[model samples]
Target chain A: MSFKKVVVFPAKLENLAAIDALIKSTAELAGLDARSIYAIRVATEEACSNIIRHAYQGIEDGTIECGCYSNMDSFTLVFRDSGHVFDLTGVPSPDLDSCLEDRKAGGLGVYFIKQLMDEVSFEHIPGTGNVLTLVKYLTPDSEKSST
Target chain B: MEYIVEKLKHCDLLSISGRIDSQSAPELSEALDKIMESGQHKIVLDMSEIEFISSAGLRILINAQKKCKQQLVAGELVLAAVPERVHEALDMAGFLPLFTIEDELTHAVGNI
Candidate 1:
């Protein structure tokens, strides 16, 4: 079976709770285990936070639409925002192996979103908006172990 | 998120609960900054009650750990009683090697 839940909120840090709740309930309904659910939650949070912090920076009244789509095969999240052109692909990876003082922290959020999700795609439409989609595949073994 | 800071004999203990996402990460950073500003570098972070931590939280932890290690006093930050889910998040971020982790708060405070 498949289902979807979506929420639209102003692209502000304060509204992250509502965004987190949306993803949590969707992941629970998909019968994900504690770890997978946490992964999805963190990935989606990172996506939304990036949108708010970077995409909507200096823009007024910007909004983000998050959709949680789940099925027997996979769980997917789609984020849409009408802010500036912020390409996550262009962001460089953080130097994880570097010493603490030499390491940088700026790109971890995008890196985490890519690391946690199974498949991710970003598309931008001219004068429309940017759509970022994250997917996590579901396995029967995973579903059974959670129960 | 909520935090309680306790000044122990060898190190300061900061107990944090609730989600540490982008919004609340600033608060965590502030709390750690205050502890370091007081010339105390050794810290034991009690994360037994933390339900979730995002990359934002991880950034704060790494930055604080760096400061604790590189500061003139040269102290370390120890994570204590980390929940399983939170531990996995740290592991996924490749952060497990950055700090010493203990299974109990008493052990973290005692060792640090």
Candidate 2:
């Protein structure tokens, strides 16, 4: 069985809770583990926060479209925004070896998104906007086996 | 997310329950600020009730740790009863070895 759903919300911090709840519910319906659900939620929040901070430049007036899909064994979350296009490809990876005092403040969100998800990809369509796709495989305990 | 701050004898204890993401991190930061302003340098953050934590939450913890370290004359900030999920996030983020973390709150408070 396959399930897919989408939602569009304003690019504001206030709407983040609703988005998080939606993703959590979707993950549950998909039969994902708590860790998998947490990963998805974190990645989605990073993408949404990026839009709110960089895309809208803190305007809080733009819109964010979130699309989620899941089957028996895996889940996917896609975030689309029609705002200032960001070059996610240019994001620098965090140096895990660096000490806490030497590490910079920002950039850890993208790093966590990269580390938690099984796969992460970004697409920027000039006229359309930015699309961030994240996927995670459900663990054995969370996946429904086919008889 | 919910956070409760309690005043200990020599340190302040902040207990965080629920998810700590970008949206709820500000509340934690504000609580940290209030504790710092109260001239409490020693702190024990009990994170056993936290189910999930993101990088934004990690950033706040790092900031709080740094603040406590700056104000500490002898020791560092203490984190107590951090759940496995939060521990993994902190470990992956290379922050596990930086702060003094205890598996029990009583041990942490007693050590501080």
Cα lDDT listed for each candidate: 0.88, 0.82
Q: How much is the lDDT of residue A89 in candidate 2?
A: 47
Model 1: C-alpha RMSD to truth? Answer: 2.3
Docking class of 2: medium
Q: Write the per-residue lDDT of candidate 2 for residues B1-112, one digit (tens) a residue.
A: 8989989888888898987877888998898889888888788899989977878888888887787777647435688998876787788788877888899999999889
Looking at model 1, give its docking quality level.
medium
Tens digits of per-residue lDDT for model 1, B2-25:
999999899999999998999999
**Which one is best on DockQ?**
1
Chain B TM, per prediction? 0.98, 0.94
Which residue pairs show collisions in model 2? none
* TM-score to native of every candidate shown: 0.94, 0.91
What DockQ would you assign to candidate 2?
0.70
DockQ of each: 0.76, 0.70
| Backbone N/Cα/C clashes per model | 0, 0
